[model samples]
Target chain A: MKLVCSKANLLNGVQIVSKAVPSKTTMSILECILVDTTNGEIKLTANDMELGIETTIEGQIVEKGIIALDAKIFLEIVRKLPDSDITIETDASFKTVITCEKAKFTIIGKSGEDFSYLPAVERDDSIVISQFTLKELVRQTIFSISDNDNNKLMTGELFDINGDEFKIVSLDGHRISIRKIQMKNSYAPKKVVVPGKTLNEVSKILPGDADSDVTISFTEKHIVFEFDKTVVVSRLIEGEYFKIDQMLSSDYETKVKVNKKEFLSCIDRATLLVKEGDKKPIIVNITDNGMELKINSALGSMNEEIDIQKQGKDLMIGFNPKFLIDALRVIDDEEVDLYMVNPKAPCFIKNVEESYIYLILPVNFTTVA
Target chain B: MKLVCSKANLLNGVQIVSKAVPSKTTMSILECILVDTTNGEIKLTANDMELGIETTIEGQIVEKGIIALDAKIFLEIVRKLPDSDITIETDASFKTVITCEKAKFTIIGKSGEDFSYLPAVERDDSIVISQFTLKELVRQTIFSISDNDNNKLMTGELFDINGDEFKIVSLDGHRISIRKIQMKNSYAPKKVVVPGKTLNEVSKILPGDADSDVTISFTEKHIVFEFDKTVVVSRLIEGEYFKIDQMLSSDYETKVKVNKKEFLSCIDRATLLVKEGDKKPIIVNITDNGMELKINSALGSMNEEIDIQKQGKDLMIGFNPKFLIDALRVIDDEEVDLYMVNPKAPCFIKNVEESYIYLILPVNFTTVA
Candidate 1:
């Protein structure tokens, strides 16, 4: 394979596909990135059995061929190359030569036939969604997914699509985060559980602007996301996601509207006394005029008060500060409403118009004093 | 202690002293920062046995008292507090109360008497120097300090003061780096070995600009640095430094002058083909017009050439790329001269006016082919 490409274009293509390259794998071929110059385009592909990525770069091709090179070394070489045109050529014996300006590198390459290709799926059932909205959905909900591998289902987020609305939900027993967005056009109903790792990688590579759209297709075992000259295919977790709707309720004895920034700051301060091994909880007391947050530990105690507009009965509750901080950080609104059924039930942070809700389970406390 | 200070001032003071706070120490009191409001000044002090730091913060003293609080918790509380005047008060029992704006914290504190005090060093043998130059001297030679603990003397840099010049030297058995600067005034000659860790911390806290000066005093067992509103006292490493001057020679068969940046980039690229376990050396071939750098490994080979002005005989030599890269990265000169004695002896990178020299031993290579 012989190709001449700009350093910037080649670097971008290699980085995008390298996300799928396994750092350590049982098969040595999985650690290599397959470089192919075919169909008048240069493509770099990497597959780690569970995830695969392929990205194309615009280049001048002298000949069409295929070869696989160690992803780590290849990436370093490309990144360190001077900002000029880079010529990469490989012979039938898989001897790859890369040269740029005064620098030249000759590295041994493996046959591309041993590398696995991304599994192709039918595109008839694909759905096109705004890349911006898709990235936001993952960023808002992915943090709630369980990191513990004991419950494999909890380690993935459920993508539920029906008609023109798409709902993404993630829960880790302690909290549940759900983001719902409306698609421009209607589509068939479908449900798929995507591994948290795949969603994270997709979010990183997705375009930041809303001008572009990402086409997503899901099969029985795999889900594919294609955007910006790049395609990502990941294995879907085979299990039924928990029914999260049953755990959410609109009924509440107390409702308070507070500034999100102020509330986050108060809780963050209260957590200062909470040590690493200490399972201390922050207590929230909502009154008609304002709210009081307090945390007491063997080391010390903290109390902070922020004015708020409240309705319904006065309530007191305790919760893990990290869960509240996590939900509040992703919220982009100025004012947020907190709905509490009682001190024993979960507290829901809701934005009715945005169709977003974060439910944080309260810690049972005997007394505030 | 009772005092009222701006949140920013308190945070700065805590951060400065917290560097000496040991993460885990046999004496638990060493983990706490001592806060004292005596003589109408708010002082924060922390000692980790090997090093001690004390800094004063501007504040209004409501009453005179003293207490020791957990350094980590105190710093966090001050950092998260609103940017307003903070009120900190401690009772006779050492229970501390810190209040800022609408936030209030009551943390457990120990008696100030339990905190170790900074060792007092006589100022008779003190030397005044620009903080900026001291920081630069540390940065230029600290990387060459031995990370291995086998030779404790090599883990520190020798500070040789003679007449009106200050020279710092560090060697790690593989290479020797020396940085020398002229002091404004002459003084009695003194030599001391400062631990690399102490130099690193001093560099971090020193002001970047040359507006301020640091007063350094050395005692039999300890060294003290006083600057700005802070004081740092550290234990000195005791041992005789190696005679590095004998290892350097002026005789050479080849001398080459090349652009520092170009040489560094070429060496960096050649290192890409070198594996973790592979002790591959980059061979430098110097000619009258240009220089060629080559690296060969089982994986592949890399060759790069950069134009240079050469004097003396043409020569070929091999050396570890890392040692060369480290010295070149710290050099500030645009054009650097290299003096080599055959392919077996050490090579010297020197700037006579700057009083900076780096001597790197050559790696024996059988053939360049």
Candidate 2:
């Protein structure tokens, strides 16, 4: 295979797919990236069995062939090459030669026949969404996904679609985050739980511009993401997601509207008193004109009051400061309404439009005086 | 202890001393920072037994008292506090109250008597050097220090002071680096081996202004550095540093002057051909017009020619790319003179005055052809 590509274009293509390259796999072939020019285009692919990424290079194809090279070495060579046209050629013996300017590299390449390619699924049921919306949805709810693999289902986020409205929910037993948005085009209702890792990698590769749209197709065993001349196929987790709606309730005895920035900073400061391995929770006390955030630990105690518009009964509750900070950080609204039923019930941070809702269970504190 | 200090000043002072705080120590008090409001100044000190740092904070001393607080929590609290003035007061029971704006913190403090302080050294044999000069000298030679603790002397750099010239030498068995600078003032001859860790921390806290001076005092077993209202006392490694001067010789068969940037980049690109467990040496071939940098491995081979001013006999030598890059990265000269005796002996990168010298032993490549 022979191809002449711009250094920048080749480097970008390699970087996008290298993220899925298996670093520590029993099969050594998984560590390599396959450069396929069989279809008159140079396509770079990397697969870790569970997730796979394939990106096309914008270059002129001189010959037609296929070869797999070590992803790590290939990336380093392409990145260090001069900012000009790079010529890559592979011989019948699979010896690959890469040249840029006066620099040339001859790296031993593995036979492409041994390389595993991403499974191709029929694009029968697919949804089109703006790249910006998908990126934002992943960033807002992905953090709430449980990192522990004991309960495999919790490690993935639930993507539920109903008519034109799409909702993504993530829960880690301690806290839950839900983000709902309206799609421009309506489609069949579908629900799928996607591994958090796959979403994170997709978010990184997506373009920053909002004009571009990404096509997401769902199959029985896999989900395919196509955008920006790249296709990503990730294996879906086989399990039923939790019924997040049943876990969320609107009943509350106290409701407070507080500035998001002020509330976030107050809880952040209170968290300083608690050290790692310590489950010290910050207590929030709602009064007539303001709310106070407090954290008491063996090392220290901190309290900060933020002014807010309060309604309903005065309440006191304790929660993990990190849970609140995580939810508050993703809420783009200036003011967030916090609803609390009692000290034992969960506290909810939601907006009036019900587009985004965050529920954090309060910690049972014995020393709340 | 009672003091009202600006949040920025308190944070800066705490950060400087916190570096000396022992993170994992048998003595719990070593992890705490002492806040002493005595001698009409609020002084913060942290000691890890082997190394200690003390800095006076800019604040108003309301009452003369002393207490030790957890360094990690104190720094976090001060950093998150309002940018206004922060008032910290300790009660008789050692319950410290820190207040800034509407935020308040009550942390448990230990008695200051249990905290170990930096040894007070007499200003007997001390030399005053510009902070910039000292910082530059450490930056130029510290990378050559051995990270291994097997040979403790190699983990420290030798500071030799003679007449008005101060020379620093560091060697890690494989390579040796020497930096010498003429001091503005003459002092008694002294030689001390300062631990690389201490120099790194001192470099971080030095003021950026070149006019500021740092007073370095040498004792029988310790080295004290005083600068910018902070004093760092570190126990010197007790051993004789390697005789690096004898290891370096002016005798050579070939001398080449090459552009430092070009040589460094060529070697860096060649390193891409090598893997972790492989020690592929980059061979430098000197000729009448230029120098050719080449690296051959089982995976591939790369050769790049860089134009240089050559003299003497044509030669070829192999050396580790990392060692050459390390020395070239720190040198201030645009064009560096490389002197080599043969393919087996060490290659010396030095100048005419010998102000800076880096000697790297050649790696014997069996596959050299």
Model 2 lDDT tens row, B209-255: 68999999999999999998999999999977776667879999998
Which prediction has the highest lDDT against the true structure? 1
lDDT of 1 by residue, B36-147 (tens): 8876799999998899999999989999988999898899999999999999988888888999989999988999987788887786788889999999999999999999
True contacts kept of each: 0.95, 0.79
Model 1 lDDT tens row, A262-360: 999999899878888788888888887689998998778889889999989999888999999999999999999999988889999999874899999
| lDDT for residue B353 in candidate 2, whole number 0-100 | 98
How high is each candidate's interface RMSD, in Å?
A: 1.5, 1.6
TM-score for each candidate, following the candidate numbering? 0.96, 0.94
Candidate whose TM-score is highest = 1
